[model samples]
Target chain A: MDAGLIFYGSAIFLMVMGVFIAITGRHLIKILLGIDVFDTGLNLLIVSFGYINGGTAPIFSKYPNIFKNVVDPVPQALVLTAIVIGVAEMAMGLAIVMQIKEKFGTCNIAKLKELKW
Target chain B: MIRRLIALLVSLYLGYILYSFVYVHFPFGERPLRGVAAHYVENGIKEEGATNIVTSIVTLYRGFDTLGEVTVLFLAATGLGLILAGMKREEEEKPEPTLIMETVTKHLFPLVLLFGSYIFIHGHLTPGGGFPAGVVIATGYFMMFIAQRSFTPSEYLLSATESFAGTLYVIVGLLGLALAFSFLDNVMPLGIPNRVFSAGIIPVIYIIIGFKVGSEMTGILLHLKEA
Candidate 1:
């Protein structure tokens, strides 16, 4: 329970920090850094869900065993998938930033002119 | 100004509606999934001849869903590749990382790759699985890229691995279609549990996925850095 609070609190903090970066940061890289913070927070929340008290590795030995020692692997797997997706998203974001710089000669957020539909 | 005000009002209304509808965490009075999973476990090992129920469900019973998910990834990678293909990294005024990072990354990279491959191979018996292992493997390459100035990965090798893994995945699915009852049907010899060849084609399929995902990840990182 204590861990849950820590996880959720940090998740909220990182998410808010990310929003702040995206909203007010002057540089494009700073915005990407903020997004990474948000992603890390989400990954931490996911890992916390798979947390079991005193849980060990999920390996089985051929005999009777205590089941409480193994936290769920599904969430861990899901986090892995999410992390890859995050990489792809970040890459695309950076790629666009590169293109923007080529076209506009800067990565300043205030200088963006292609914001409209 | 009036348009802005109207848009704000609409957004507020929608936000409130969304807040009311989501994240309540109420009891749904549905049948216990725990019981269902437990019952499935009791009977599944006998029926499927596999100890790991998660592996069984993912590979044997719900194989089609896994295939769809892989295909989704394949599509996403393809889409992103098209968008970012010619994109180049624009590093402004920043000095290269220190000599410590250079020395440490070059020396420690092999160990990291070894650990990642070990995780993928032992995934069926252990907590770590393919996706995480793939990322770890990719990270090893990523670390090399970051530490060294001219250590760009081979795009030809990466694309080949990606295509090979994806094609093998579909081939396995079609084998199930041809010989077995359903798609991705687990027909390979299920060796002794906890052994290297155990879990039949499940581990093989996972390895292929790991290869594809790792290569795609490395390729994306390379493209981003080079772009």
Candidate 2:
């Protein structure tokens, strides 16, 4: 019934799906997609936490004095940074995957176990 | 199938734990934000001269964090370059793009570039900022690469702009240290809020960040293509 509950529930569901994909997927790209999904879920969770019942954005362009019912901007800022970092991490991950494919001639996690400690 | 089932079960358990943790700790949509958030919302506009509270927080209150974030991006780009350095390039014949598509791409590229610059320039006064703008610029270049398959972006130009932007960011931050209180401080006069040139060093930093991110992202995309 509550919107917050629904939002959080969906976020958790996506996170679970992401974890399952990460754990069960064989290919490197699939694992990367899983991580991206997980990142999205985390961002959603953060933005949802900052939500108020009927809060506007924390910008002051429209209503300078509407501070009483504004959503928290901290999470939004942090999420922005996190999203950029996630992209960089994903790019690097894909690059490493390409290298692995070049060297090992495959992208399967099982095949990559040779380098495991 | 068994491995997938086990993974599903583990994920469900982890999800349950996370859900409970969130439910217990953060009562979503119920409580008021306290401490730093409250302070930012209250005094951000006055002090930072940015209507967008999030922008103020990202560039003014916690600018050092943003610097670190940019460094992380730079390192990732460098790492990608290093990893793909040894790959041999093979020259292959590619199909020529249709005249219509080429014309459309040529027309749209400048528009996309303009929009990206607009986003970065008006970051302090608007919702969009440097990161998104940089990605948009990279997208424009990507479209160009696709349309004009033989057209190679000047690597020297991309690197030059990237380095210049990065150095300028640091210099501006250092200016803050020398002139103002601390690192990345708002040393310049905070002009009228909601204007293009307001928000002191915030827009300057964001614009530099935009240039750096755009060039680096384009480089990364180009590198991946080559790889």
Q: What is the DockQ of each candidate?
A: 0.18, 0.80
Writing each residue's lDDT as its tens digit, candidate 1 over B105-147 gives 9899999989988877776666555667778998999999888
Residue-level error in angstroms, candidate 1, position B160? 1.1
Q: Write the per-residue lDDT of candidate 1 for residues A4-25, one digit (tens) a residue.
A: 4565456555655565555556
What count of clashes does model 1 give? 3
Please give the range of 10 consecutive residues that has the lowest summed lDDT in model 2 chain B. B86-95
Give DockQ: model 1. Answer: 0.18
The iRMS of the candidates, in order, is 6.5, 1.1
Off by over 4 Å in 1: A1-4, A7-13, A24-26, A33-36, A39-80, A115-117, B1-62, B87-106
lDDT tens digits, residues A55-83, model 2?
Answer: 88988876355457788999999999999
Task: Give TM per candidate.
Answer: 0.74, 0.96
Whose TM-score is greatest here?
2
Q: Give the Cα error of residue A26 in candidate 1, in Å.
A: 4.9
